[model samples]
Target: MAGDASPAVAALSEAELLSRIFPRLAVDATHSAATLLGPGDDAAIISAPDARTVISIDTQVQDQDFRLAWPNGYRSTGFDVGWKAAAQNLSDINAMGARATSMVVSLTLPPDTPVTWVEDLADGLTAGIRGLGADGCSVAGGDLGRGREISVTVAVLGTLDGGPPVLRSGAQPGDVLALAGTAGQAAAGLALLESGVPMEQLDDGLRNLTERQRRPVPPLQAGPAARKAGATAMLDVSDGLLRDGRRMALASHVAMDLDPDRLGPLAAGVEPAARLLGRNAMEWVLSGGEDHGLLATFPPDIQLPPGFTAIGSIQALGIDEGPRVTIAGRAADTGGWDHFAD
Candidate 1:
């Protein structure tokens, strides 16, 4: 009986591996209102209570999107990968001012992968959904297959609760720009992950930053709250604040002028980690991605939501000037995650 539980996925039949995974994927929800039919079928049937469905999909590839082990000798656990998979997709739904209903995941795994790692990933998926306050969401179904490296793809379904979606193009010139959740923490964590410092030597704060990179805490509730508070434009800050701000500016055809006072606190939060590496914390705040924080624009007349803080204001674009993000009317230092960039 001890010998039967092989360490590697290669030793197990596909059916056997799935049997180990399915049970771990179950969320604790007594009844998922969205999922009329979940798993064990040709497709999942999720209810669209608002007469419309907000859907989003994302993919993560090993070695490119993430690594099994970093230079610091910190191994990326299956739980980390699974948690991130749920986070990135769920954040997208939240950005649209909708609540996640269900998700379907697909995994591509190398033959040498460990069975326990896959099981941990299943547990992580459920944990992320429940831990991130999306307890009502359901894991409807998913697929698994062989591949050269590990890859995970998740498609999420959401409903708007009879409200209109806040979009990137809706920001007016006078709108106030705001942020929900911390900035630069995940990027600072990524720096720590890739640094020469070994995992054991890291202090508690530094270690916590590393965990942020692994399991991002997206501000799921803040999204709907911002929408209710009359958010004009919004998106998850998965691609650094400057880059994403530029995107919002371009879409709305306005300039976004950041207030240094608002950004200073965020920079200070990660200053210790940045100092250890001889880097600037403010740069991370500008270009750091994967924090999954929401960047939103709201009308000046309304009260800002509970989790949101004013970070900037929207301005009219100057003649012949393209959409740009600036701090105190000056150009911002620009660098963000660009997958194909040299």
Candidate 2:
């Protein structure tokens, strides 16, 4: 605590820290219409207009999920963690074809943590909720505690707006597989953050990659749009494409064959990083995750929803075999983020 920015959060009483955090999390009552009551209460009351609420939760841990300082000399900021917390949780609700309405975030800080960093995290959470186009969502309430490492957990609630929630098991053979956001850029960005290259030496495009790693932009609008367009099944590409695609295939009881030509643009986005890092861009696109893009399947007759482009098609499962994701009629490698594997 001597050299640290501020004596870890331990020095400040929980009430004292709450006093500092509340102001940063205040929301406009006009915009946060769905939240009947927010923070300062035992639990928040949210208005679920559709009478059904969709819920999801996700967690990020220090070092395991993110690093304070990277090999490239870049330091992870509180804002980065806060934004990512919002992104990943919101992405879960999005995958269900629902619009997020409220979120409760829990934070665990180490003894040496800086007060300024916590404030920045609060600011980042507010910014992510607004900047990421979740206009209807608001921070309801959360918990804080002392822990060995920084940890963040977010539980979010969403509304289907009276529509049926899209499920992964709804996909059928002959459905058109589509994607609604950039792929591989974030994995490329992660590579840049962990690279030995000096930050100053990176060009704007290269730096952009790192930005994605720090703050991913999940396509919030695409979810409802796909649902409106009758998307049969969907999920967020949080894990690598192959990994998540394999999941969708299994859930839908179908096989998926991605068109390499359709994936070219996604791969191209990471070429600069791939070349610099001596890695394969296509691999990044195929196996990379964390962009929070939507992966959905739509019926063959209708036009894909806005912000979506067809990348593949659903097919019947192979003879006596399970569902799998393939490229050019061959099973693709399922390599992506695996917490247990790591």
How far does residue 192 in candidate 2 sit from its true spot (Å)?
0.8
lDDT of 1: 0.91
Tens digits of per-residue lDDT for model 1, 251-313? 999999999989999999999999999999999999999999999999899899999999999
> What's the distance in Å from true for residue 200, model 1?
1.2
lDDT of 2 by residue, 227-286 (tens): 999999999999888999999998999999999999999888899899999999999998
For model 2 the local lDDT of residue 105 reads: 91
Candidates in order have lDDT scores of 0.91, 0.91
Model 2 earns a TM-score of: 0.98
